[model samples]
Target: MSNLNKLDFTTLEVSGRNYLKWVQDVKLYFTAKSLKATIEELIDNEPANEAKKATAMIFIQRHIYDAPQTEYLPEEDPRTFWLALADHFNHQKDIHLLEARHDWQRLCFQDFKSLNEYNSEVCRI
Candidate 1:
């Protein structure tokens, strides 16, 4: 196993609703550092569902920030927390796609005063 002292979990902080990507990145980081066994140990030590949930929350506490002064609650199962974030962000992504489509549909060459400006606007869209 690699030296755990040199690893910084803080660098894996989960910001916004990018939980899926964040989780993948964290897992890869852990694997790269040969700390995958450490994660298994954490899960193994918590036998009961409640214990596992609490353990998960605590394990990820410093690595996640849902809001200002608000972190994942003890009642939240880490799996549930990640799933909820994934679902929420997926919905937001759909909304963003729709907005982009609307904006693209409304874009017009006449809105720009010059050929170069119109080309830039089209490229932006």
Candidate 2:
């Protein structure tokens, strides 16, 4: 196995808009290091809950932003904290989908400088 201390895992801050991508990145990071079980045990506070909680809290804090960081207390169950984020982001995803659909419906080629620009705009949306 690889040395956990030396690995430079990707730092992904959950900014409400990128939760899905963030979660996937984190999972891949841990799995690559064979540390998924270790992380779960730490989050669960198995043998050294307090110390583990402190370590887990720091890790969680580093990967989250603003409201979510404050909303889910570090003292609470880490699973619960993760679940809350998932729920919040899932709802936001639906709203974003609706907005994207609306934006696509209203998009027009006339709004761009040229056909190339128009194609780029379409790709962006």
Question: In TM-score terms, which candidate is top?
Answer: 2
> lDDT by residue for model 2 over 23-59, one digit each (tens)?
7776676567443543454555544345544555466
Clashing pairs in 2: none
TM-scores of all candidate predictions against the true structure: 0.44, 0.61
Predicted model with the maximum lDDT: 2
What does candidate 1's lDDT look like per residue over 58-89, in tens digits?
A: 55554565561163353365555555555544
- As a TM-score, model 1 comes out at 0.44
lDDT for each of the candidates? 0.55, 0.63
Off by over 4 Å in 2: 1-15, 35-57, 74-76
TM-score: model 2 vs. ground truth: 0.61
